[model samples]
Target: MVATADLYDERGEELASLPLQLRDLGGVAEFSGPVRTIRCFEDNALVKAVCATPGAGAVLVVDGGGSLRSALMGDLIAASAVENGWAGAIIHGAIRDSIAIGGLGLGVKALGTNPRKSAKAGAGVVDEPVEIGGVVFRPGATVWADRDGVLVER
Candidate 1:
């Protein structure tokens, strides 16, 4: 559970910092794990499906195309993540029910909050490399996030 600042100081050249000013919305302040990615836009069916599976302490990295018009996840999916043992979630988009999600025992970082939920078209790619904020979040890459920011390492 090293602080983001310390991690950066120790591995400044090796880690890639997520440049977006993501908000810390979950109860847990620090979380890190191997990356699991989803690439979609305004659809959350895959997000729900992934959260239902066993996380094995991995972090779900959702590439929502940086859209703030709709939410890709909410309280229910986040609760599922906790129940299934996901270490955390880093969403490159919006999320709803921020207040409720903040109470859950999961680490969630997102671009911002929105009240409108996303569609359930079930259209998206999973376990793929998703680039957000100039970082390519590939499957199996390790990600760490704290109040300072997120950092990724291959």
Candidate 2:
């Protein structure tokens, strides 16, 4: 957590396919863990399920159809993730509870933040391959993120 460079160096060498030095989000905090992918539109019911399970050193990657109109994760879900020991969450859309989520000691990265919450129609799939920011994220892939964007390795 404190030494991102060291961790990156270690993982980077082993996974030569992973890109190095991605786009930096200024001083955005980094979260390290394996990738748990979710392919969903606006529903986050499956997301909640994955986050509620013991993280076991994994990051929840939710592909929310790249919608900025609604937030996929908020303070309530984020609090659950933290309490459940998730390493972090990478949403390919929007997230609410910026004030509260930012204060928590978790790795959170998304296209941006929004105040609108998503619907609970339960209209999404779990453990499916999802695309975000031009990258293909398959379930069980390793995801390392920091201020310097996100890196994925099988």
Candidate 3:
């Protein structure tokens, strides 16, 4: 995968939107996949369910309402995503177990890190268009992410 720095150089410009302060957790290789979207806040049960499906190289775009009060993704869910063959995950919130997530062979990006887990009240929607990082992610849309930020194409 090309670094965001390289992408910018090659593309001749940077995307107007998208969070560029995300940490690049190593271990996950660049994967090409379908796009799956989740709109929720703090809760990730729906995200888990979708990721648990037999993914054919699909990326999960999660909109956690940009809430950092609770982490939306942890090591367990990340592991589950890998086991389910998900290509990657882009969280519009905090993620816990950053170290463990970095060790898994999965691509992950989030606003920041949090140690607190989310409430399991089962609040979320799957296969929905989510707006995050100034981008509207629709289910089945093509999403590619590397160091140079995320690029989406219909």
Best by TM-score: 1
Clashes of 2: 0
**How do the residues 19-113 of candidate 3 rate in per-residue lDDT, one tens digit apiece?**
54666653564644567988889887787777778877899888888888988888888898889888899888888898999999889988888
Q: In candidate 1, what are the lDDT values of residues 4-108, reduced to their tens digit?
A: 899999999899998999999998989999999999999999999999999999999999999999999999999999999999999999999999999998999
Q: Which regions of candidate 3 are displaced past 4 Å?
A: 1-20
Ranking by TM-score: 1, 3, 2
User: How well does candidate 3 score on lDDT at residue 4?
Assistant: 44
Task: Tell me the number of clashing residue pairs for each predicted model.
Answer: 0, 0, 4
lDDT of 1 at 5: 90
Would you list the rank order by lDDT, best first? 1, 3, 2
Clashing pairs in 2: none
lDDT of each: 0.94, 0.73, 0.77
Task: Give the clashing residue pairs of candidate 3, or none.
Answer: 4-147, 4-148, 28-106, 33-57
User: lDDT, candidate 3, residue 126?
Assistant: 85
Q: Give each prediction's root-mean-square deviation over alpha carbons.
A: 0.8, 3.7, 2.7
For all predicted structures, in order, the TM-scores are 0.97, 0.82, 0.85
Model 3 per-residue lDDT at 52: 76
